[model samples]
Target: MSAPLIVGSVAYTPNVVTIWEGIRDYFAGSPAEMDFVLFSNYGRQVDALLQGTIDLAWNTNLAWVRTVAQTKGACRALAMRDTDTVFRTMFVARAGSGLGGLEDLTGRRLALGSRDSAQAAILPVHFLTRAGLTPGEVDFLRIDSDVGKHGDTGRSELDALRAVLDDRADAAAIGINTWEAIGRDELMPGALELFWESPVYSHCNFTALPALSEERATPWVEHLLGMDWDNPAHRPILEMEGLRRWVVPRLEGYASLFEAVREQQIGSRW
Candidate 1:
């Protein structure tokens, strides 16, 4: 019998356990049996993937960028969630803060989530810089909550939002997911409003080294793509993971981040 395919993921929330368990159960009857290991952070998971301790990793954009850089573009992205393809960073402020746009952020206190978070921190700064608002142009109030987890926890984004609400900062940079979540859950209803939205970028994906053969990888990818979102058996896992369908990775969507990391001089080596 073939060994089970080992996958690594960060334990960002309790639901991670449920998600992976369901995936394992789903693959039990498939040709490619699967198992998972959870890490406290993405850095460690990325390391395991590079070190060949795990065959695949559920990597965030930052992790994926690092892997590509560290491997000199030799790594492969197998698939990503449908929701992961259209992610955007949002700049929000108190409903009546009078912030018109990115230009208005100049000389004002702007809060950001964990430094490593592509959506909440990295891309926000990147977008602001692209809009002519350099780091020195804004008074930054950075919240580094759940840093190593690469903003997967969303704790820092929430803190940044609270900072804006409490008058601690004039605005906050957060992921579109958090923005929608706040509306869906009615968390602090109407206290915040979107000041700006970033261009769309990709988020998370299944990354693997070149050494993982197509023989093993193809079956796994096929099984993931075969998941039926409408089926009751798969719906719960799909909802928990925040995607209705698995799609092939869009390499172009990652160009901004690749340039941002170089421009910002963020360390690629985990």
Candidate 2:
């Protein structure tokens, strides 16, 4: 068989399985011309993208920034989900815990989502630094779920939520959609409260090395944007990802996130 499209991303199990299979199904109608592969983390996924083991990838904001920096913008953002826009990361605490803001986190144990998470870790650290709180000043524990997906893996956020529920942490960092997903699951809705929210930024988008020609890339992205959210075939996937539709790709929407990752470089050791 010809080479598969070699999609790379984390497997978010029941909630995010739609991300992989849904995109595959969308491309399946193209005369069976493409196929995909999934990865558990974004670091390795990006490595594969650079090494040519994969043709394209669904990259997190941080990974896209790294990809652009590494490739000098030789890669391209193909498409993204509509819900990926206006996304925020939230700081949460147990109800009645009396925590007012990040300042209160001083000397307290805080649960961060993932080491590679943009929302839960990167941006949070950047904002924290802006507020004059440096890393290692507080007790920071990481709930590492989707390493390569860069905390788009809701599993890490879920772990932080549970830590707050069980009284293990004074507060936790989580993506807003992940927090909402927990509410849908009836997980401690009233027991937890949002203490702080990061400014809006974009999330996931398709990143590919510049080898794929525009002729092939155009239809691949067009098919994704053209997916009908109301159609039965696409509805289940849309619900699973907490979105109504996908959108045309844009990197400018994520410039703030890229800048955050660049300025903070919290996990440069990685």
Candidate 3:
């Protein structure tokens, strides 16, 4: 028999090992027995995927776009979390700051997360541009604590929020996940409040090239989608992975990110 199918994921946190180990255990003795390798960042993971060193890559939205760019749309997005289907970016400022909307950002200071981040950085800029704000119109304060691993987005975005609270920036851009993580509009009356939110987009996905055949891919996807959120044994892993269930990727959900990448002239490679 051939070797187990290999999957690549970035080591974004210590618990990542636990998440994959639990998943590997779940696949034991299945028709598509699998193993995993962790990379330090999405760039290395994408490189491994392209070089055929790994059969599948768990990729962030930006990494997925970069992979598509490199493959010229030859790659496939196999699956994604349910949460990945409706991701959005939020432009926030201190509550009662009188920053009404995207247009209010003109000539104002905007703090952004890492330059590589799609939600906090790329899509935020795209939204600003859509509002007719040019590059020179907003004084951008980029806080890039977590540079490569697009995971742990909270770090940079939280810093951006601090920039707003401390008066360094008039507003900040961050993911909706980050917004919720901070308790949303109810966190505090005088703290952060959302001024504008980008339209929904997709997030992380399992990316594969043509080399990973359908024969090998089909059963794996089937078993993945079978992860029942109600099953006590499956619940922990599902919760840790931040999804109730895995589903076939929504290709259309990536359209905004694709547009943003193209408009920004972002290179195909990370």
Candidate 4:
């Protein structure tokens, strides 16, 4: 049998290596083999998937939405990390900045993650609009180290937090999980506080081209869902991906978020 080509972004190479190694080991024990190609941006990754250069891609929800919007449902979701199913974006402030809530952010400087970060930038904008706020209403400072990986590299999130510490912004938008992870790092403590959280939304998933065969998809899905969390074999990768399990992909979970984004665009147009 031929090898499966996996496509993904390059910003998170450490985590990517973990995932690729795990997949390689899983498939090595099976009848088929797999390989991967890392791209620097989602546009290239999505384009490759569409042009059939890669059989499957682990894509962010934003990338998947772009794909579906462009292709009109020509792609299919295969599986996803359990952690990716529900994630929230958090608005944070310095521990004693006196910025009590979303309403207090008016005219205040705010640091946001990367421009392309759905969790830290896009969805936060949606939530802000719902809170009766607009991006221009505040001094928007951008922390843009990991642009294409969409905050998955943690660079943008960390920079946002540092901005809060340095008083660059009265508040910042960051991934909720990344905030918690850094807060527990023992090296960083009590420097920032969480003020608000965006409604949970889906994040990452595996996508397949319309022409992908079921025979190829089945083993990939099976191995993913069957990963033994309790066993030593899959522990490192699971920890790297921040998941204890994997689940079948579901596109419907993103409907509310998509609606919110679309509605926000409409409001912007007027």
Best by lDDT: 1
Superposition TM-score, candidate 3 onto the true structure: 0.97
lDDT tens digits, residues 116-199, model 3?
999999889888888898889999999998999773547999999899999999999999888888898896777888999888
Local distance difference test scores for all models: 0.92, 0.76, 0.91, 0.76
Residues forming the 10-long window of minimal summed lDDT in candidate 1: 181-190
Over the stretch 1-270, how does candidate 4's per-residue lDDT look in tens digits?
Answer: 666646454547656776777767776756446777888778788888888888887888778777776678788898887878778888888776777777788899888888778787777777777789866887778888887776778788888878888877788888867877775334555677777777677888888877888887887788678887898988887887778999987677677557655765522110
Model 1 shows how many backbone clashes? 0
TM-score of each: 0.97, 0.85, 0.97, 0.89
In candidate 4, position 99 carries an lDDT of: 75
Off by over 4 Å in 4: 2-11, 184-190, 260-270
Residue 92 of candidate 1: its Cα lDDT?
92
Q: lDDT at 141 for candidate 4? A: 89
CA deviation > 4 Å runs, candidate 2? 1-6, 14-22, 29-32, 135-137, 184-190, 266-270
- Compose the digit string of candidate 2's lDDT tens values, residues 53-162: 87788877888888888888788888787877778878888887888888888888888887788888778777777778877777887888666557765778888878
* lDDT score at residue 96, model 2, on the 0-100 scale: 79
Please count the clashing residue pairs in each candidate, in the order shown.
0, 3, 0, 0
